[model samples]
Target: MDLEKRPREGSETWVDPRERPAGPAVRREPDAPEGCLAVAIRIPVRIVVLVLVVPVRMLWDALVVAGRFLNDTLLRPLGRALLWLGRAVFVWPFVGLWRYVVVPLGKALGWLGHVLLVVPLVWLYRYVLTPVGHAIAWAARGVGAGAGWIARGVGAALGWVYAWLLTPVGHAVMWVLKGIGAGLAALGIGVWTAVAWLARYLVVVPALWLYTWVLAPLGRAVAWCCKGLVWLLSTIVTGIGTALYWIARILFVLPALALWRWILTPAGRVLAVVGREVWDALGHAWRVAGHISLALGRLLGTLLRWIFVEPVRWVYRSVLTPVGHVVRDAVLRPAAEAARSVRRTTRQALAAARESVRQARADFRRMLFGEPRQPQPVDRREPSGREPRTLGSSTTALTKD
Candidate 1:
């Protein structure tokens, strides 16, 4: 839908902005016409580039396929295995130690510190120190009030003396000093006026007359002489410049221009056309070579699949698979069952004997100690990864609650 309103159908002056094309309205300049030389150059250059690029494109494609095969078959698996080994060797042990040992120890130390130091400090701050600080603050407030009162009394006395005794004496001194200052300022002003008048007549008047009368006419004459000299020098330089310009044109510039206009320009245009043709041919050849290489690679992959992969796959499916299944059912299953039976029997017998020994020890302990006391359980810490964990599962006691 067009959000902008359309131009009125009757209005010849109005054009709808939405009706205009998305791009700029300006037309593209047409390509210049190619001469016979460029046309002639393009075909041969493309043929040569195509011939040269085909083999290289095929080689590059082969290297790419080989590198991919090697990475998938060998390098990728080796890198994954190394990464797993590094994690197992370097990372997992530290994680286990931190989880199993350090975490527990840290929790125990934190609890001990809280009980031993933090509790006492908190008690002292809440009881003894808080009361002492409050008492001291209260005493300091009282002392401050007394000091403020004393300060106010002293300030009042000082203000009274300043108002009554010092004010009149300062006023008398200021009046006398004002008279003396006025007399001194008048004397200085008269001396300054006399000096200014004498200096004006002695130095300033003479300098003004010299500049206005004698020096002014002399400077005008000098300036006129300088102007004439500059004009003469400029005319001589201009003549030399004109002569040099002609000499340079005859000796170098005209010949250079002639060489450029008659020889180099035409040659450069020809070379430019040839270079453009070569560059275009290279790009075209490269694209064509890419298509050829892709086709060749597909053909080669199809041939390899028929010759190697299909035969091996067929052999594995038709020949080995049935035989392996038969062996697993007939031979391996019975062997595994027998092993499991033996293991179960051994474990059961061992467990029964251990139970007997434990019962005899318990009987002896009861007989000797008259029923041993059971120990109490401590607070359970957070469970580690020894237990199986499921996704989205939490082991925290609060979560269970």
Candidate 2:
């Protein structure tokens, strides 16, 4: 405050320089109004829309155009190419599947057809061939049978012809020769008989008489000498016989005693053994006999029943029935008819017998009296008293009549 040096009444005094206010304080601008800020934001947004959005829209439109062009041009061809490649990839596998599966199935079906055809063929061959072969064999057998029969017949006929024709001729020739031989034998036998008789009567008779008369005496003398010698020889032989008989008796007795001593000691054991053997043999024989007897009895019973009873029964049924019928028809009926016929014939014969006897009596009287005395010379004609003509002339005349 000084009026220049006077202090100003209301003014404050300045402080030290250090404490003085710094240079003028910088003023800060005032915050804008909300409406104004809004107005400014709207204006920038409008400008940004004009500047960015229009260009982006134009670029998007171009991209869209480019994508549509790419879809139309490149993508369609690529898709078509991929589809073709996929089809190419699968085609070979499909062909291989058809070859592996379908072709094998076809071959299997063909094999089945072959089996079906072959099986029937084999069956037909078996069935038809066997029967046909059998039939052919039977036909061959029949042919053989026929040939055998023909051969047998021919052989039989030839044998029969030989037997009947040739054999009989040969037998007749042999018979004639046998008859001639028999005659010759008879003649020879007669000759031998005569020679034997002549020899016995003529030669042997004298010889026998000579032997009896002469040789008998000589034989008796010689026999007397022989008897004397025999008596001497008998004396010598008797001495030798006595010695030999004693020696033989001693030898034979010794052997017999030895044999009895040796054998008789074991006789009981031997007999026991023999008895056992005999018992076994007897038992065996008994069993065999029983078996045989049983078999034989059965056989005999069967034979008796078959041969005797069965045959008799069969004969009674078979033969007797027919035999009885035959007897009735053949014998009884015929005999009955014969008896009736005989009776009828007898009756008829009896009825005709009187007339026959009368006729026979008349004939007998006529024969005895040289003709019945006819009415003597009824005077129908003159009696020619000439003797009757000779039998020869009358026979001739009767023969001419």
User: Candidate 2, residues 46-84: lDDT per residue as tens digits?
Assistant: 443344444444455557767988999999999999888
Per-residue lDDT over 199-246 for candidate 1, one digit per residue giving the tens place of the 0 to 100 score: 999999999999999999999999999999999999999999999999
The candidate scoring highest on lDDT is 1
All candidates: TM-score: 0.68, 0.23
What's every prediction's RMSD, in angstroms? 14.6, 76.5
The residue pairs that clash in candidate 2, if any, are 1-6, 1-7, 1-8, 2-5, 2-6, 2-7, 3-6
As a whole number from 0 to 100, the lDDT of residue 111 in candidate 2 is 93
